[model samples]
Target: MSLFEELLKWDKDQCRVVGKKFELGSWNKLSEKDRLGMIGELIDLLCQRLKIKDKPKVILTTLDNAFGAFSPSENTIYIDRKTLSKGGILTACYCST
Candidate 1:
């Protein structure tokens, strides 16, 4: 299976095994626009850390079940809204990279 498909399957499995939900901090309590801005900043930090010349496109989606995924072919990163809502930006960022 493709990477995306594998990620999707993993996410589905994760949803079935629930533990304590992620906590939302003050930073995560910000407005949607502000949160997206934070995500952009995180992406910049990730690119710098990874020393990637061509930065991948970052997309936040409510439809996706996964916390985050990187598509090498599209050079894009997908982060789930649920993750951000749960104050999981750092987790998502690490996973994406």
Candidate 2:
């Protein structure tokens, strides 16, 4: 099956990780608009999970996809499987934007 399909099958007990090595230069290649768009999507996902029918409280936890050698950028946001399942969000799309 495809990687996307595999990730789609992930359950609360599973952990998703990225094994590729990335450099700041690679990230810097993206336009500022693209970065903002990515960040916005993450924030929207958080809002969806909090079920913000009007206004809601949100707690976001972020981490690198790597095992332990690297960290996400200061601005990157993440959610683990455990927290994601407990949250009200019904679907997840990884690297899909």
Candidate 3:
């Protein structure tokens, strides 16, 4: 199955496997650059699939209520750092979707 498809099959707790597939080790072991790069790749993948010409910017922050949010007005996607720290890129991608 495609990575995205595999990701969709996962629950929040099982999402760390997605990071391992990308050779990111564990979420805590991932570096900032790698995390951002993964997010960028997922966003690009999503945009390409949707035929979206303008890719949105990704912002990582601490959030209490949400895992991620996409703002069409600013063409930006905001991801909670806690999600990354705990669930890794797969969870981020799932949240973005």
lDDT of 3 by residue, 25-72 (tens): 454566777777766776666666556899999899887798888898
What tens-digit string does per-residue lDDT give for candidate 1 at 5-54?
65443443333221112224545557766777766665565466455789
For candidate 1, give the lDDT. 0.59
Model 2 weakest lDDT span, ten residues long: 14-23
Tell me how candidate 3 scores on lDDT. 0.66
Which candidate number would show the highest lDDT if scored against the true structure? 3
What's the true lDDT of residue 97 in model 2?
A: 22
Q: Model-by-model lDDT, in order?
A: 0.59, 0.36, 0.66
| lDDT by residue for model 2 (1-93), tens | 775565454432222122011123433454544433433454454445444443322334443562112123433334443433333232233
Clashing pairs in 3: none
Candidate 3, position 70, lDDT: 80
TM-score of 1: 0.57
Report the candidate with higher lDDT, 1 versus 3. Answer: 3
Number of the top TM-score candidate: 3
At residue 84, what lDDT does model 2 achieve?
Answer: 38
The clash count of every prediction, one per candidate, is 0, 0, 0
